[model samples]
Target: MNKPEAASIGLVKRARALAPLLAEEADEIERTRRLTPKVVSALIKNGLYKSLLPKNIGGFESPPMVFMEMLEEIAKADASTAWCVGQCSVVGMTAAYLDADVAHQVFGKPDDIAAWGAIAHAVQAVPGGYTITARWDFASGMRQANWLGAHVQVLEADGTTRMRPNGTPEIRTILFPASSATTHDMWNVIGLCGTGTDSYSVENLFIPDSHAALRDDFSALREKGPLYGITTYSMFGLGFGAVSLGVARATLDAAIDLARKKHSVGIAAMKDNSAVQGLIGRTEAKLRAARAYHFSTAANAWQEILNTGKLSEQGRAAIRLSATYTIHQSAEVVETAYHMAGATAVFKSNPFERRFRDMHTIAQQIQARDNHFEDVGKMILTNSVIPRGPTM
Candidate 1:
C-alpha cells in the first residue's frame, strides 16, 4: 500500500551489528542446534528475521542481494543461527503472498511473529484436507515459529487426487498453527545443533480452506498489491542460497586469517606454506565466482519483477536452478577451506571446525546443494521427463 521504511534501514549495517551477538554464542548454538533465548531475543529486537517481509509489516522488504550479503555476515558469526533464521524468514515471505485474511490469521498475532515449515514433503489427498503423512525433516526454525506451512494435494471423495481443468492436480500449501502440531526431537547431528530442525507432524489435521492457498492464481495477487506479484517461494530460494554463499565466504575468510598467524611444522608459519596459500587462494576465488553467479541472477530477477510484475514459469525455474548451482559450488569451496584448516581444527576448540560442520549442513539444506545436481539433471530433460511449473 504505502512505501515501507526499507530504504532507511541499511541492511548491511544491521547485519554488522548482529554478527558479534551471533559469534559470541556460536558454541551455544553448536550445543543446542537452536539459538539461545538471548540470541533469539536480540534478533527480534534488531528486526533481523523480518528482512524478507514488506515494511508494512515492520519488515525491511530488502532487496534480494540484502539476503545474500546479510547471510554471509551472520554465517561468519554462527552458521547454525544463520541457517535457522534464513529458513524462518523465508517462510514469512511465503505467508505474505497468501490471501490477506490467510496472511493475517497466521502472521497476524504480533509485529515480530515468524512462521516456519517446508514445501518439500508431499501430502496425500482426501476430503476436507490432505492426509499429510510425510516426514518433513530439517524443519529449521520450527522451534521458534508460531505457525507452519506444509505442502498438500487436493483429493476427490474416493481418495484419488483431484485433477484441475487442465488435467493436472492442484498442489496446495496448508498453514497450520503450531499449537495443533506435534514436534519430534530428531535434530541431533554433527553440526547446526541449534537449528532444532526436528521432525513434526499433523495426523489427519483438517486445516480449514482459508489457511491453505494456491501459488498459481495471479488475479488474486493483482487485487492485493505489487508485493504479491513477487513469487514468495522464489524469494525463499534467494534467501536460503544467500545463507549458503555467506557461510562459504565466511569459511574462506576464517581459514585465511588462521593461515596468516599459524605456521606449518616444517615451514615458518601456515602463511608461508605454499600449500596452504594455494588452498586459501583457491577457496577465495571459488567462493567469489559462485557468489557472483548467484547474486547476479537474483538481482536481475528482482529487477525484472519490479519492472514486469511477474516471472514466467521458465524464468522462475532458471533462477531456482541458479541458486541450486550456487549452493553446490559454494559448498565445494567451503570444503576446500576446511581442508586448509588442518588437523588442529578436529580438536573441537577451533572455530574453523564448527564452521566446517556448519557448511556441510548448509549443503544438506533440502533445496540447495544436495538436491541441486539431481534437480538440474531432472530439469534438463524436463520436457520429456519432469514436468515443469507448480505441478511438479
Candidate 2:
C-alpha cells in the first residue's frame, strides 16, 4: 500500500512536549484508581485524546500509523492514558460499521464521547430487537464516556438463539446509552489501574432495532465512505498495539538510565556489561520493526481506500495481522528491557515495574496478539472463516 504523506513534523514535537504532564499525573491516577477528571480534560484539550476521531467531527482523523506513533509517546509517559484513549478511538471507528442513522446519532451529538464493551456473557431476545443483561468487565474509558457499544449474541423470534453459518449462535454488537447502565466500583487490579475498567451491569436493557449492528455484515451498513474500507478496523490493532509498544519503549529508556549509574558488587557499572548493551540494541531493533510494520500495513489498506474507495477481505486480514504482530512483539521487547533493569523491576512504585505490569496486560486485551495469530492461522490453513461474534 502507498504511504500517505507523512504527518506534519510538528505533531511529533507536540507529543514530546506533553510527555512530562502525562508522567506527572501517573501517581494521581494510580491513587484514585481511575484517571482523574483533570487528566482527561487536559488530554482532550491537547488533542491527544481524540487522535483517531473522524475528521468530520473536529478531529485530525489521522491515519492509523500517526495514531500508533502518538500512542507510543503517550505510553512512554503513562500507560494508562494510552490505554484509555486507544480504547476510545477504536469505538469511534466501530461507529463506521453501524447504520448511517446510528452512526449519526452516535457522533451526531456535539459533545458525543464514546466507549465500548462486550457483554459476551449476557444474552436475551425480544421481538424486533434484543435484551442485554450482564456485567461488562474492563469497560475502559466508560468513566468519561457518553455512550458504549456492548456485544451480544442474538436470539431469534422462535426463542432460539441465532446461529452463525458454522451453526454457532450468531451475535451482534449493540450501542447502548452509557447512563442507562449502572457501574459497579469493582475495578481493583494491579495493572492498568487508572483505566477504570470496572464492572458495569445493565439489567434487561432493551436496544431498538436500529442500534444493533452485526460486524460480520459490515457491507449492509448504509454509511459509505473511505472510512468504511477494511483498513479502518486496522485501527483497532494499530492504536492498541502502539500503546503496548510505547509502554515497552518507556521501560527500556528508564532501564538504560538506571543502568548507566548503578555499580554492581562485582561490576564497575551495569552499562559496562556487553550483555546489557546487546539487550539495548535488541530493544531498539524491535521498536523500529514494530513502527515500520504498523505504518506499512496501515498505508497498504488506506492507500487502497484513497485510490479505489474500498479494500477487499484479504487486504483487511493482512493489516489485522500486522497490528497483532507489532503489538505482540513489542511486549517481548519491553520485557527484555525489564530484564536488563535487574531485580529492581519487582517494586510496585518503580516506573519499571509499572511499565512491566502495563505491558503484560496487553496479552489480556480482547484483540490480543495471540488471538490475532490464531485468527490468521485459521484464515490460511482451512475453509474456516473469521470467527464472527459479538467481539471482533
- Which candidate number maximizes lDDT? 2
Q: Which tens-of-lDDT digit does each residue in 1-392 have in candidate 1?
A: 33453452466677778888887787787776678888888777677777766555556666667766777678778777777777777767655556666665666544345455555644554545555655465678888887876765666666677676678776676777777788889988877788888878777677666666675455444133344455766776776678777777777777888888876656678888787777777777777877777777776676666777776565576667877877788778778877777775676777667777776776676557445556657667666232232321
Count of backbone collisions in candidate 2: 1
Q: What tens digits encode model 2's per-residue C-alpha lDDT throughout 1-392?
A: 23222432334456777788778888898778787777787666666655554555444556666677777787889888778878886777656666656776786544566776655754566777777777777788888788877777876667677887778776676788788888888878768888887767788888887887776455554545566555435667767877877787778788888888888887768888898888788778888887777677777777777787676676677767876777678788778878877788888677788777777777577656467677778887876443221222
The pairs that clash in candidate 2 are: 1-300
The models' CA-based lDDT, in order, is: 0.69, 0.71
Ten-residue region with minimum lDDT total, candidate 1? 383-392
| Model 1 alpha-carbon miss at residue 362, Å | 1.9
> After TM-score superposition, what is the CA distance of residue 141 in candidate 1 from its true location, in Å?
0.6
Rate residue 131 of model 1 by lDDT. 56
User: Which residue ranges in model 1 land beyond 4 Å of their true spot?
Assistant: 1-9, 109-135, 216-219, 222-227, 369-392
